[model samples]
Structures are given as structure tokens and as C-alpha cells.
Target chain A: MIIIAILIGCIVGALIGINAPVIPYTYSTFLAIAVVAALDSVFGGITSVLKKNFDLTIFISGFFCNSILSIALTYLGQKLNLDIYLAALVVFVGRMFTNLTIIRRYYIEKWTSKIEKDDKELQQ
Target chain B: MKIKIKKEKLVMSITIGIACFALMLVMFMQFNMVKQTDITGIETMRESELRLELSSWNEKYNELNTIYQETVGKSEEYKNERESYEKTYELLSKELEQLNKALGKTDVEGEGIVIQLTDKAGTQLSEDVKVKRITEEDLLIIVNQLFAAGAEAISINGHRVISTTSIFSIGEEFLKVNGERIVEPYVINAIGNPDYLKSTVSGKGGHVDALKELGHETSVDINKNIKIEKYEKELHTKYID
Candidate 1:
């Protein structure tokens, strides 16, 4: 039932998003940075869930805050004539990689333990 | 307890799903905008390929312009040649007219005056008195006066006076004009404006009055149409340029 709800929500949200009008070229850079931040947040959420410590409120707040902070930084960078977005990108991508590694390790360990238990049962 | 957990899970999954959907949508839109903004797709082209295309197009334009200039030059040359041909044709026709006039091959006609000079009537002259008649000298004077008055052509008794003409006395009653014998009364025809020719001859104390005073009967008449025959003598040039 949970999986069905998630699937329905994802499909509906995707449909709405696909039909939405594109933003102006000037704001696209901010959107790109926000997207990167959102992706990092998603990976972080997945990693936390795999570790059995996921908090819905924290995940939601992180997703929105990270995107908003990155966009604000990009605008400030334009005012200052600095490439602050590059710094933000680097940090977000690095965290995403770390989260991805954690997720990968959790899945590998779970799969290996399941296989080991099956072998022990067969030996008995 | 199981139902409560299941409800909580469902809510969390829905939220996560919505976030994921939003992320995907933003990614698609950004991708589309970037593709549209980069129209030339220059990022995909190598530097050498761009330079080669630019140089080839420039060469093509230069070749086309060269061909255009060559055609323009050829047309200009043809125009100059045609103009030169027209000028030469005009010059040749003008020379042909001058040659015809010099050769006296053209029969000419124009508005002019005719003068008749004869001896005084025999009834008015006694046998003892010397009778004055028109002579070669008198004829020469009249011809010179007519030429000074802008006569274009002159003839006396059907004989055309060209540059080679000779006037002399043939006998006491006959005169030679252009080697042709002419008798009195001598008829002189001159082609020119009749008004100016008449004024030149009949003016006060002019040549006509002078001839009348010399006991020669003279009459002047203005004729609108006067024809002069072409010189019939064969011309022989001893020397020419």
C-alpha cells in the first residue's frame, strides 16, 4: 500500500512537472544549482533510510533548505562577480558521493548476510 | 499497531515520491532550456572544423566576386568598342561629304539672286559713239563681289565655276566662263540668301549701280529657287598631299 501511494504520487508529480513552462535563461543557472542541491539531499535521505535513522521532517527540510541556499548563493555570486556556485556544486556533489557510498555499502552487506544465512541453513 | 506503522510509512513514501518527481521535472526543463539557448551547438564542434568551414565560405565568396568583376570588365570593354565604332562612322560620313563638295559632284540648289548684264540698245547708241559691253574683267569683279557676299555656289550661262575655272574674252561679243563660250546678255546665277545678296549688289553706290553707270544694261532679280549644274570637266591634279 505504501509503495502504491509513492508510485502514484511520483507519477502525478512528474506529469505536472513535464507540463510546466520553462523558466528564463537568466534564472536557469540558479535552477541548476538548486537541482544539484536537491539531488544531494535525496541521496542523503536514502543513506539515512538505509541506516535506519531517517527522519521525515529533517529530510524534507534539508531538501528545501539546500536548494534555496544554493540558489541564494548563486545570485549573490552574480552580485559579487564571484563563482560561488562552483563552490556549492563541489560541496553538494561530494556529499552526494559519500551518501551514495553509504547506500551501496548497506545494500551489499544486507545481500551478503542474507546469502550467508541461507548457506548455514542448508548445511544443517 | 501494524496499521499505525503502515499509515506512517505511506505518508513518508508519498512525500519522498513528490520530491523525486519535482527533481526530475526541474532536470528536464533545465536540459531543454540549455539546448534551446545553445543554438549553434558550438561546444560539439572542434576548433579546426569551425575554422575550415569559415575559410571555405570566404573563398567561395571571393571566387564569385572575381567572376562578377571579370564579366563587368568585359561588358565595359564591349561598350567602349561600340562607342569608338560609332564615332568612326560619323567621322567617315563627314569626310565623304567634304570630298563630294570638293569634287563638285553634287548638283546644288538654294535661294539666290540672278543678274543679267547686256550692251546698251543699238537705238540708244549712235554709230559714232563707242559702245560698252560686259567683258571678262567686269564678270570677274561681279563674281568676286558675289563670293564676298557669302555665295556658296556660282554659275554663269550654264557653266559652273570651280577652283580650276578660267574666265577670258573669246571675241569682242563673246566671253569664256569655265572654258565654255558664253554670249551677251550674260546671265550670272549665285546661290546664297537672296536678301543679303541683293543688298550687297544693289546697295547705294554698289557694284550694280557701278555697272549701270558704265553704260551696261544691268538687272537684278531675287529667285527663291536656283539650280547650279555640277562641273562636267574631268579634273587633273598635278600634285596632291
Candidate 2:
């Protein structure tokens, strides 16, 4: 049921985005960093749900806070000529990979255990 | 306990759904923005570097053209062995010079008039009426009028008016003459009888008067000596004899 809701939301969002007016070139960098942060939060949310530790308040706060922090870091990087966004990108993407591994293992173990149980029942 | 669990599950699904929607929307918008911009895959160079490269290329071209002209002139002089050949060479050279002058390949100087056209000040014009800036057609008409009044050579903004020259609007803000972009405060110089040229362009109901009526600043000055430079573009002909 949740999967179906997410799918519908994505389709509607894409349609609205396609028809929306574009933002200026100057702010595109900030938007890009924010997107990476948001993507990390989504993956983390999925992992927490699989582990039965999902909290709505924590998820929402993480989503907004991560994006804002990344944008601020990008601005500071520009002012300092340091390219600090590279550091943020590495951290976020690394965490995303870890969360992805956890989600993958959970689904794989569930499917394998179900198959094993069916085989034992057949023998009995 | 069962009903409460069901309500919690519903709330969780709704929250996730909203987050996913926002994420997809931003992603799609970013994608669209990237596609719309034309700078993809092209590295931008510093402005100074680009300018230096252009100037060097132009200098090289000018040096080569001068050398080529010198060599051609020497060959014509040395190859004329017979009286008949020498006479033919003399006639051909004269014809070439006249053709070059007519084609705007040679610089010209004489008495003429200079006409200046500029946009009206924004503060001077009434808010209801739009101020008129000079257009390509207006410049073309003025050039035609000068030629009709016996002007021999003409130039607009230092771009010599030649047989192949084209003046057209590039956009609302700029006009292109002989494929080079030019901006406002256009100065047109013509070489001919100064009195005749001024009378033709600045007379009653002429182009200058028309421009003034549309709220443009216009002026004409007669000069004893005006020089029009040779057209800088190389003329290419494929089908003509």
C-alpha cells in the first residue's frame, strides 16, 4: 500500500516539475546540493522503516536540516573558494550506500527464509 | 490497540508519500534546468584569454594579406617582357584599381556630411509615448538618400558601405552591418559634396526629420574633409565570371 502511494506521488510530482518555471542559473548549485541531501534522507528513512525504528518527527527534521546545512556549506565554500560541497557529497553518498546495503540484506533474508520454511513444510 | 496501530501505519505512509513527492519534483526541475542551459560539455575560458587569442589571429591574417599583395605586384611588373604585354598589364592594373574603388576595397576621402542619430533621453519623453531608436531600415534609407544626392563613398559606424554589405536588425537592442554587430549612437559618414549631402538627408520630411518626430536626437554636420575606410571583409564569388 505504501509503495503504491509513493509511486503515485512521484508521477504527479514529475508532471508538475516538468511544467514549472525554471529557477535562475545562480541558485542551481544550491538546489543541486540540497537534492543530494534530500536523497540521502530518503534512503535513511527507508532503512529505519525496515529496522522498525521509524519516527516521523526525526525523519522530517532530518530531511529539512540536511538540505539547509548542505546549502549553507555550499555558500560558505563559494565565499572561501574551498569547494566544500565535495566533502558534503562524499559523506551523503557514502551514507546512502550503507543504507541501501541494509535495506537489500533485510529483503534478501526475508525471501530466503520464506523459501526455506516452505521446503520444510513440503517434506513434513 | 489494533485500531491505534492501523492509524499509525496510515500516518507513516502519508508522511513517506509527501517526502517522496517533494524529492521527485525537485529532481525533475533540476533536470529540466540543466537541459535548458546551453553550456553543457563546453569549458568556459577566461575573458582576457579569449580576447588575446582573437587579436593574435587578426594580426596574423593582416600580415599574410600584405605579403601576398606585395608578391603579386612584383610578379606583374617582372613578367611584362614585351611592349604589348607591358601595355596590357598597365590597362589591367588601371581597371583593377577602378574596380577596387567601386567595390569599396580602397579608402576614400573628400568633402561630405556626417549624420549622427541617438536615442532620446528616457526622462524627456512622455510616459505614454514610446521613444524611437534608429532601426536598420532607417539607416538604409538614409544611405540611399545620400547616394541619390551624388555621394561617392559612405560608411556607418566605421563599417564601409559596399555592394555586398548587409544591414539588418539582430534583435531589439543591436543591428548587424556587414555581419558585424553595432550598437547605438550611429554615426554615418558620406564623401561627396557637403552641401548636397546635408540638403538631401536633413531637408524637410527627410529621414532625419522623420526620426526627430519619433523622439530621436538627430544632427547633421558638413565637413571639408571626411575619410571612409576600405571594407575589411574578403569578397567571395562562386558563379560570377
Candidate 3:
């Protein structure tokens, strides 16, 4: 049921976004940074869920807050003639890598242990 | 117990679905925007490249401005020169017309007199048979008298008299003025003061009265407007320097 809901939401979102009007080139920087922030939050949410410490409130808040904060930073950076979005990108991408490592380890450990248990059961 | 667990799982799924929905929406929107934007457009140019492009355009604009100013100045100069040229042409043309008038090369008009001399010796009664018919010398004397009275222009029998004019006879048969044959009655036109011209050619000692006593019919008329034609023959000196 959860997978079906997620699939439906993604498909609907994709359809709506495809039909949406294209934004100006100047604002594309903000959108790009916001996407990175949202992707980072998603990775973090999945990592916490695997760790058995998932909070729906934290996930939702992180998703929206990160996107907004990054966009604001990009605007401020333009005013200051600074590349503040670069800092945001680096931070988000680093966290995403960490989350990915955690997800990868968890899956590998579960698979290896399952194979060992099957071998022991067959011998018994 | 089963209902509570189902409710909790449903809520979690719904929140996750909402989060994913938001993410996909923004991601796809950015994708479309970036896809439509031309990567090679000025918007995407680096700062240094934009600066360079702007500077070159400014240089080109300044060059064109200089050229435009120079072209305008040149046109103004040409306009002034053309105006002066037209003025000189007009002055020269007026002077040439005046010179032609003075040279007797153009027709003249003024208040003057007309004289007609009819040689009636052939039909005259009791006239001396030896009184020769009107001669070139008689006509020449009358012309000389009209000139002395300030006649500005003169013509005889349609022949204009210029500085080079000659009055003579080809024989006793015909008279020649400006080398063209003329017969009686000789009609002479002289442009001048009308009363002055008539009085000079007539009266007691005048050539007309002298010719009248010899049986030639002579009459002088004062005219308000008399036109003397221009000299047609070209005047060129062969020996005079």
C-alpha cells in the first residue's frame, strides 16, 4: 500500500510538472539548489527510517525548510556577489553520500546474514 | 488492534507520498526550464565574456557616430558650394546679356520714329528728267542725321545696321544696306526719343526735305514703340588687333 501511494504521487507530480510553464533562466539557479536540498532531505529521511528513528514531522519540515533556506541563500549570494549556493550544494551532497553509505551497508549486512542462516538451516 | 496498526501505516505512507510528490514536482519543473533555456545565450555567458562583448559594441557605436558626423559636415559643405556656384552663374549670365545688348547683337525697343522715302520720279509730273531717283547717298545722309540726334538703334528694309554696316548701291538699279538688296519705298526704323528722331530727319535742311524737293515722297512718323531687329551677321576682324 505504501509503495503504491508513493508511485501514484510521483507519477501525478511528474505529469503536472511536465505541463507547467517554463521558468526564467535567471531563477533556474534557485530551483537547482532547491532540488539538491530536497534530495538531501529525502536521503536523510530514508536513512533515519532504516535506523528505526524516523519522525514524519521532522521529514516533512526538513523537506520544505531546506528547499526554502537554500533558495534564500542563493538570492542573498547574488546580492553579495558570492557563491553561497556552492556551500549549500557541498553540504547537501556530502550528507547524501553519507546516507547512501548507510543504506548500502544495511542492505549488504542483511543479505549476507540471510545467506549464512540458510546454509546453517540446510545442514541441520 | 489491527485497525490501529493499519491507521498508523496509512498516515506514514500518506506523508511520505506527499514529500515525494513535492520533490518530483519541483525537480521536473526545473528540468523543463533548463531544457528550454539556450545554453549558448547571453544569459548564460560568463562575466568576463559579457564585459568583452559590451566593450566591443560600444567601440562600434562610437565609430559609426564619428562617420555619421563627418558625412553630415561634408554634405553641408557641398550645399554651400553649390549655392555660391549658382550665384556666380546667375551674375555672369546677366552681365553677358547686357554686353550682348551693347554690342548690337540683340534687338532693341524704345519710343522712336519711322521714315518712308518713296522715289516717285517715274510718275512725277513736270519733274526734271535728270533728277536721278533716290540714291544710297541720300539714305546714308538721313541715317547719319538720325544717329546725330541720338538714335540708339536703326534698321532699313528689315536689315539691322551694326557698327560694321555699309550703305551703298550695287548699281543704279538697286540699293544695298548690310549687303542685302533694298528697294523703294525705303522703310527705316530708328529707336530713340520719338520727337527727336522725327525732327532730325525732317524739316527745312533735313535729308527728307532735301529728297522731297527732288520729287521723292518722304514722310516721318513719331511712334511710341519702335523695335529695331538685331544684327544677324557675325562680326570678326581680319586685320585689326
Candidate 4:
């Protein structure tokens, strides 16, 4: 489910990037997607607060990271004058790498360590 | 007792699932908002720039048009001055021609008169004429025919209608005056001998009558002392030299 969610986010970001060149319509569509993404993030933050594990820095960092990445990607694409498809590809690559790194470090590696420590303590 | 334990596990799993989903949703929503703000900011800046560009273009166009109309407005005067210059040249040439003729030279003076037609009253032309309107092509044909009949000086409605003159109806009421706006009762005036000019202008199947047929009345007046005035310098346009 987490993988699917990440895939969906990346896909949404890519689609938004691809359609960014279409003048007037681009403005509305860009706003709509960003709003939806922000709402989803807010929902996550609320649940964390409810669970009493709320770290504003962590939540804020994630927010800034994705927003900055998306904007930087767009700006870099324009600065380099890349074609639309090429720009979309760049955004996709950037998003995928960042998401995978976060997931691996936070979920997989940490969980495996905790589980291994628990098994040793139980045997002792 | 076994059933109660299973129910407790089920409740815990459901709660965890809901909490996680809600947490994810919040995170995504916050990120999305920031991204949108950035994109909109960039777009707004770009749009403002485009508007400024468009406005500048319009200003330049208006400046040129003002210059053009001012120049064209004084066309009659320019034409008169040009004719005077040409006349002096012609007289000198004629003297030379006479000398050359005496010396068995084949040079001869090319004599001709320029005629112009104008409406005495500044009344709007009749419906038929308004419907047809005046066209550059029509003016060209008239000028060409006059030149063919040996016309020397040519002007129309106080404006030295040139090769570039485009006569087309503008909007619902006005005519395009040098791509600017102008109203009707266009007067066509010429400088030439009456007898020869009348005969030459109105002779055979002519366009003068065609203009009349369209309903905007046309009167070909012959002026023996048709002293066309000198054109004052244009106020808007400038010259590099």
C-alpha cells in the first residue's frame, strides 16, 4: 500500500509537470493538484498529532522537501530549456529517488534493526 | 473469551489503519499546498511581463500612426511643391529642348495637366457609394488613367493619395485613414487645364461616372489658377538626415 501510494504521488507529480505548459489551463490544474497534495499531507499531520508523536520539524521538513523539489525541477527545466517530456522525466526520476531513500532509511532499515535487537534480547 | 480476544485485536488493527491513513493524508496535503503556491507565483510573474510587452507594442504602433496621418494629411501641399519644382525643371528642359531642337536634337517637351475631383459640400456620400466605399484599387485605376492621358500633378481630398494609400471601410461608420480613422465626404482635387483635363478625365468609358453611379456625387472642376498650396512640415514624423 505504501509503495502504491508513493507511485500514485509520483505519477500525479509527473502528470502535473507534463501539463504545465498549457497556458491558462495550466494555472488551474496546477493549483488543484497542489491543493489536493497539501490536503493529503495535512491529514497525515493531524493523525500524527492525535497519536501524540507529532514532530513539527519532521512534518515541516517533508513538506518543504517535496515542494522545493517540485519547484526546483520546474525551474531547472526552464533554465535548461528542456523539452516537456524531458522535464517530466527529470521530475519523475528526482521524485522516485527521494521517495525510495526516505522509505528505505525510515521504515525498512530501522524496523529490521529493531526486530534483530528484540530477538537477541529475548534469547539472552 | 476467545471471541472477545479476537474482537480486541480486530479493533486495534482498524484503529492503526485509520490513524496511519489520516496521517498520510495530512502530510500529502501540506506538501501539495506549498508546491501550488510556488507554481502560481511564477505564472503570475510571467503573465505580468507578457501584459507589459503587449502594451508597449500598442504604444509604438499608435506613435507611428500619428506620424503617418500627419504626413499624409499634408499630401496636397507636398504635391503642389513637387509640381512647382517639376515645372521649373520642365521649363528649363523646354528651353534646352528648344535649343536641342534647333540643333537637330530629338528632345521635346511633354505637356499635360493634372485634374482633381472634390465634393463641394462636406455631405456624406449617397448610400450606393457608401456601400461600395473607396478602394486603393479604384484610386490606382484613376491615377493610372490620368497619367496615361498625360497628367502632371495628382492629388485627392487634400491628401496626396499615394501608391500606399489603402481605402477601406473601418468599423461601422468611419473609413480607415492611413489605417487610422476618418469620416466621409472625400474630396478629390487636381491641378490641370480644364479643357484638356475634362476631355481626358470624362472621355469614353470612365470611372468618374462610375463613382457618381455609386451615389456619392462627383464633380470634376477645372481650375485655370488652381494654385495648390505648399505642404507644411509634418509634426509627428522625423527624418534622420
Off by over 4 Å in 3: A119-124, B1-10, B41-44, B47-52, B55-241
Query: How much does candidate 3 score in TM-score?
Result: 0.63
Clashing pairs in 1: none
Better of 1 and 3 by DockQ: 3
> TM-score of chain A for candidate 3?
0.96
**Residue B3 alpha-carbon offset, candidate 1, angstroms:** 9.2
lDDT of 4 by residue, B95-176 (tens): 9876643332332222333333333333456653333555555566676666566554454544443334456664545555
The candidate, 1 or 2, that scores higher on DockQ is 2
Candidate 2 vs candidate 3, lDDT winner: 3
The DockQ for candidate 3, computed on C-alphas, is: 0.67
By DockQ, is 2 or 4 better?
2
Question: Which tens-of-lDDT digit does each residue in A66-101 have in candidate 4?
Answer: 444544555565567553334444554555555455
lDDT of 1 at B163: 80
Q: Which wins on lDDT, candidate 1 or candidate 4?
A: 1
User: Each prediction's Cα lDDT score?
Assistant: 0.82, 0.87, 0.88, 0.52
Q: Model 1, range B153-195, lDDT digits (tens) per residue?
A: 8888878888878899967757888777888888889899888
Candidate 1 global lDDT: 0.82
Which structure among the candidates has the greatest lDDT? 3
TM-score of chain B of each: 0.62, 0.62, 0.63, 0.37
Q: How well is each residue in B1-241 modelled by candidate 2, as lDDT tens digits?
A: 9999989878877877787788888888888887776573322543346568788989998999999999988877676556678798899999999899888999988889999998674534665767766789999999999999998889999999998889999778789999999887899999998888888888885787788787888899999889899999899999999
Question: Interface RMSD of the predictions, in order shown?
Answer: 2.2, 1.0, 0.9, 9.0
RMSD of each: 9.0, 32.7, 6.6, 27.8
